[model samples]
Target chain A: MDKVILAKDVSLSYDSNQTIIKQATFSIESGSFVFVTGASGSGKSTLLKSLYGAIKPKQGSLIVGGVELNNVSKSKLNFLRRHLGIVFQDYKLIKEWTIEKNITMPLLINGYEKEVTLNQAESLLKHVRLKHQAGKYPMELSGGEQQRVAMARALSHNPILILADEPTGNLDEYSSQLIWNLLEGANTQLKTTVIVVTHHIPSTLNVDYKHYHIEYGEISEIN
Target chain B: MKSIKNHLSLIVALISILFSIQVFIVVERSIDAYKENLAKNYSVVVVSEKRIANSEFLSIDGLINRVEELSPDNIINRLNTGMDQKNINLLKLTLPKFYKLYLTKFPTPKEITTLRKNLFSNPSISKIEDFSNNHDITYKLLVLFKGVILVFAIVVSIVTMLLILKELRIWQFKHSERMSIMGLFGAPTWLRSAVLFRLSIVDAIISSILIYLIFMYISTNRFVLQQFDNINIKVVIFDTLNDFFLLLGVSLVLSILLATMIVLGHKEEV
Candidate 1:
């Protein structure tokens, strides 16, 4: 399988004095479900950010979806990001927009036709079981429902890669399970590479997955 | 309610700017019309030692529109006290030539001086009465008024533009979260800030319409017409089609440009 992400001795830092991820080397294969686990401040979020070109690798190469991310231009970063879906812990939905409109955001950004985007949004709203609340704003939705909306949005564009940073960190057990099921479904059905950053992997997750743990600024795969 | 307040701020700023521009245009047009009226009636009295040809007057300055000889018949007739025809004819022959020089436009004080100098360059020309004392005061007052209006317009425009920028920045701050959310989803800059642009553009249109209605009413008001009539000057207060379109264009451009600046200066949160 082709590698969706490749990092060779990649070092990341917000400033020069402190390095977060130190000389990390890894490659994620296409269509693989991967979990990155680390304690607080272990640079898990920072590493996840690097995958989407939000945080550039301070040293060495980092490639995502066949595009080199080191020293990438803003337009090139934006282009790369368009093909990637990202779910945040806080569920970064536009509060003013309706949940249905939020689901259509990715499609709209991809220049999908309005009718097609709306139809896709409708189907996704049903899939997320929020069809009854389509017109409701994000603020009106519960935390779990909002995350589900965020999940529906991430999967809406059929992106090549999906990055989730503690997607269910604050959700209840049922909501967390629902988010996991959605992630797994996308992985098996769509053949999308999934990289998730979390402190713990749920024991109930049934999919065959790879695990990478971070400690003392070092990232290593666990068999 | 908050959104309406935001819209109101931008609309108010745009109205001030457009009002200043319209006032400037009206003042300029009024001054031009007044100058035209004055030019028709104003003339320079030139006394010459001998008959000066019309061609010679034209050669003095390009501003000289026409020259008409002031026939000495009236004064000579008033002086005729039972004089014989020969003596009267001799008196008329010896009289110095008086010519009224009309200019194409109202002469500024500097232009009046230049005309005086040019006329005096001819030794045969003896005296020039340009009525500078009154002309200078009127011209100076008009110039002062124009200068004051221009400065006022510029100051108002600058201050209002700054306020517009500030209001837009405040709007951006309110929408920044939404914009950054869209940005994280790979929305283009223009698409992410589409709301700001749309809001500003709508306000611009509203302001333009308000200014148009206000000016339209003032232009047709009996009091305004009577004031112009009292001053014996005809001024075009507004050109409905041309001025409306111009104000609309200015408001749109300014709002768009300011909104763009805010967007470009925004710091993406993600």
Candidate 2:
């Protein structure tokens, strides 16, 4: 398999005064489901942010989808981001827009035709089992339903990679299970590289996967 | 309700600016018309050694339009009752030639001085009466009125523009979150700011229409028309097509420019 994300001696930080991730080196294969488990303040989220160009890696080379993120220009960074999807811990759906419109956001940004985007959004709504709530606002939906909508939106453009930050951290068991199943399906069926950062990984994922544990500001890949 | 509150400052600014501009135009037109009316009735009295013709008066620096020789018949007729016709005729000839010089328009104080110098430069002319005291006071008052209106218009425009800019910044801040979310999704700057642009354009159109109604009502009001009639000057109150297009153009351009400034500011911060 080809490598989708390559980080060599990557050190991430919010400001120059304090470093979070120190000289971390790792590579994740394309079409692989990878979980990054860490204690609180272990810099897992910072590392995930670097992949999406939200945070520039300090003194390292971080590449995603064939684009180097460190010191990249804004336009180039946006271009790279268009090929990637991200699911935040808090869903982050626009409060004013309807669920269907939320899912169509990435497609719209990609300049897809209106009719084509609408159809894709409808199909995705059905996939996420929220077709009944398509016309409802994000605030009108339950927490679980909103997260599912976010997940559907993340996959709407069929991006090459998906970075999810604690997608199920605030969800119930049923929602957590559904989110994991969706992430697993994206990796196996859609062949999209999935990188998830979470405090705990469910033991019931009956599929081949990789786990990397972060402790003491260092990442070590484990079985 | 919320949308209206958001655009309150913008609407106020646009209305004030439009009002000032319209008033400025109308007042300037009115003053020119009034001056023209006054010009028709005012003239300078001159005593010349020889009779001055209308053409000669027009030729000398073109300061005056026409010259009329004043008839000595009335004064001579009254004196003839006390003296003989021969003595009266002799007195009329001996009397220095009296002429009235009509001006083209009401002249400014400086222009009046120029006209006096030009008239005095003529060797045939001896004395000229321009009613300097009255002319001086009228001219000064008109100039002061015009200056006040101009200053008022300028101040209103500048202050209103700043208010409009500040209102636009507030709208930008209010919509920043939605814009940022769209930006993270790889939306271009124009697409993300579509809402703000739409808001500004709509507000511009609304304020322009409101200003139009206001000026139109004032244009046809009894008091305003009466004032023009009192001065015996026929001035155009409004030109619908020209003024409408001008106001609309100004409104659209101002709104778009302010919105663009806000958008650029947001981009730089990002």
Candidate 3:
């Protein structure tokens, strides 16, 4: 019904050296599963960072769920992050804490009490098929298993939008298909807007998703 | 907020150390003071080469007349014949020597040891005049302890900060990502600081409990406080508490400063 994420004339650069995506613009609608594909260093991760307010755009504006990203207040940024589910390229789960604890992190940050968070985490662990590894740390789990935990952690707070840097970059075919199924489940069950960034486009991703490509500092939606 | 639960272990650790150290210093000082008082009183009756026995061999009228005629500040305590004064030659003790007397409700082993040292090789003094109206060994102990506690607090504070700082040094480079997650977790600045403050308070409580138990145990023993009556025990216990608070207060303050510095400094990137 409304734009879940939007960027107008957005540009990002480091040290005034070079601008990667100049005058780039796009809007992601709610309840959409979008795949972002690009060659190496096409600013896909940078775009996601901008959406989560981790990086301030050098020019123009980026809005997530109607809140401005450029020079936004920290309180508002925190509130924005509360509703956002971001997965890093390396599946940034804390190594010391267990899988369940990692999954409950966002909710814990959002100030949900222990019992509520625990119940939700338990359910999410079951949903992700990591129920047996609830108490296992991230390092103990395989790459695919860790990715699943990351995805579950991203989805734990019931966030409106999930931005995954690379959902299945290093996973096996079985794990990749499992990740896709989990993504599809969230999209259908919770109507969550999901944006997945990847350099690979396996032939198996057929969930009625929109496709976008990043090339030569520009973005375009594929027909 | 999540870090609070995480840091509870550290808090408990800090509290335990502080509690033990506090109790140790208190008991140590108490023992030293008790011995000192005993030694002071022993210095009077024990025949020693270091001190001259000021026995009043003259008649009562003469002794009284001479003592009264002397300086008004001089105080004389009359010795009864029933005391264990037999075979104790007061005249052989070193004469014309000043003795620091601590009149306590109980005998102190430290005072005894020290007075024994001073009077060990010399004759014992019999008749005595108390020139200084200084308080008992317990009071002197409390006063001296006020400084010792301050120093101990400073040492403990420095040690705790250095330990935390050292751990943080490793965490900064190796576990910075973890720190960022904690910062991003919506835990308040004060709450983060409370991690360290909680440790200090924990330390204080543990130290207080330990010191109190130790005092109750050691002071209750008739052997430990052989010189003091029950009333004196109560007074010493009451006064030791005063000493404990003074130390605890300093330790809390030091911990607060260190915890704030470390938490704030570590919150940001390197």
CA RMSD of all predictions: 2.9, 2.9, 10.3
lDDT by residue (A85-172, candidate 2, tens digit) is 8998888898878899999999988989999899999998888888889999999998989999999999999999999999999898
TM-score of chain B of each: 0.93, 0.90, 0.39
Q: Candidate 1: list runs displaced more than 4 Å.
A: A73-75, B1-8, B71-90, B171-179, B188-206
Model 1, range A1-223, lDDT digits (tens) per residue?
A: 9999999999999999999999999999999999999999999999998898878889989999989999888788888889999999889898778899999999999999999999999998888789999999998989999999999999999999999999999998887898899899999999999999998899888889999999988999999
- DockQ scores of all models, one per candidate: 0.64, 0.50, 0.19
Docking class of 3: incorrect
What's the lDDT for all of these models?
Answer: 0.91, 0.86, 0.66
What CAPRI class is candidate 1? medium
In TM-score terms, candidate 2 sits at: 0.89
* Pick by lDDT: 2 or 3, better one: 2
Misplaced by over 4 Å in model 2 are A129-145, A173-178, A203-207, B1-9, B77-91, B267-270
Give the TM-score of chain A, superposed on the true chain A, for all candidates in the order listed: 0.98, 0.97, 0.96
What lDDT does candidate 2 reach at residue A147? Answer: 94
* Candidate topping DockQ: 1
Name the weakest run of 10 consecutive residues (lDDT summed) in model 2 chain A: A200-209
Candidate 3 at residue A131, lDDT?
Answer: 95
lDDT of 3 by residue, A1-223 (tens): 7999888999986548888778778888999999898987998887877777767889998888889988888678777877888777788787767889889988877889999999999998997788998988889899999998888888888889999898899998877887888788888889999999998766775567888898987888997
**Residue A15, candidate 1: C-alpha displacement in angstroms:** 0.7
